[model samples]
Target: MANDKTSMQLVANGILKENPIFRLALSMCPAVGISTTVMNGFMLGIAVLFVQVCSSVTISMVKNLIHPRIRIPTYTLTIATWVTVIDMVLAAYLPEAYAKMGIFVKLIVAFAIITMRLEMFACKEPVGASFWDGLGMGLGFMIGMMTIGLVRELLGSGAILGYDVLGFKPLLFFILPCAGFFVVGLMMAFFNYIEVFYKRKKGFTS
Candidate 1:
């Protein structure tokens, strides 16, 4: 029972408290670069989810064998291996989405968010905890990217996932790189406000 509770907390922390893009401000590059549409964001998120979980589990299984001095390189190599596999599989099977995200899929190997988790949590924890941590973080990243993509796509193109909703673009800027910053910042603030409100309501001071 205690283990289950701990796992739930780890997952919740990744999704709500330590979100890679929104809360922790990690991996902002992909968050901004690929979030032009909901599908784009979601696809990248799926890749990250798989890579993160696989890398975490792999690292946990071999943490004891990895030398402390070379763990960073080991982690990078492990992550790269998974990223390459996913990239190839996507190219061979799902050519359409792969065409749109091939380059971005390769970039996940270097994402600070994934690396940081391996170094900070996965390597030091048991396999079960690390897996949950990765899952939570991956899910959080997906949610963050999807939210930004949905908002930007809807407002900038007047559509959601390429479906026209408003008949006209409301703000073309929302689709641009500059708008990515604005959307992320605003969403970050929105989540911060919610946290503050909840804390206050519960009589907690932070």
Candidate 2:
């Protein structure tokens, strides 16, 4: 039977309790590297989502077939296959975004987020639960990346998703790689405080 709490719990964990980039800080490479523009960040998130969902499902479905000693290699192979497909699709259709994203698309193969979820959750859980967990985690990742990208785009380019929002002059430094970390950190702290405040309001102990 599917665990009713699994999906909800996964959502809460990924969005609030254990965000991949914000809280757990697992996939920093893509999160910090390709998030200068909102479009790039969003596309990166979708790619990671694809990799996560496909890999989790593949691993969960075959959990019992692979020997314990060789499970990691098997899982990596599965994830790599999906990543390659995504890379090719992006390169073919979204060449501009692909060029902007640079090697981060290829780095999806090494994003620790996919492997961590496979090892920590998918390998041990049923397919349904694993799928939900992957979905939730992927959404959280998207949120984290978008949050940083939004701030950076607003400040650095005076725009949002390439559309000009604020008329303020651009701050060149906000587009730098170092600024990605700062923006992400501030957003993480903001989410953390919101989580804490919500728990306190609900009379839940941390």
Q: Report RMSD (Å) for each prediction in the order shown.
A: 2.4, 2.4
Model 2: which residue pairs collide?
A: none
Worst 10 residues of 1 by lDDT: 1-10
| lDDT of candidates 1 onward, in order | 0.91, 0.86
Q: What TM-score does candidate 2 get on C-alpha atoms?
A: 0.89
Off by over 4 Å in 2: 1-6, 192-206
TM-score of each: 0.90, 0.89
Q: What are the clash counts of all predictions, listed in order? A: 0, 0
Using TM-score as the measure, which candidate wins? Answer: 1
Per-residue lDDT of candidate 2, residues 1-206 (tens digit): 35567578887787767888878889887777778888887999999988999999999999989999998889889988999999999999999988989888888898888899999989888998888899989888988888778888889889988887887747968888888777777777897899899999999999
Error of 2 at 146 (Å): 0.7
Clashes of 1: 0
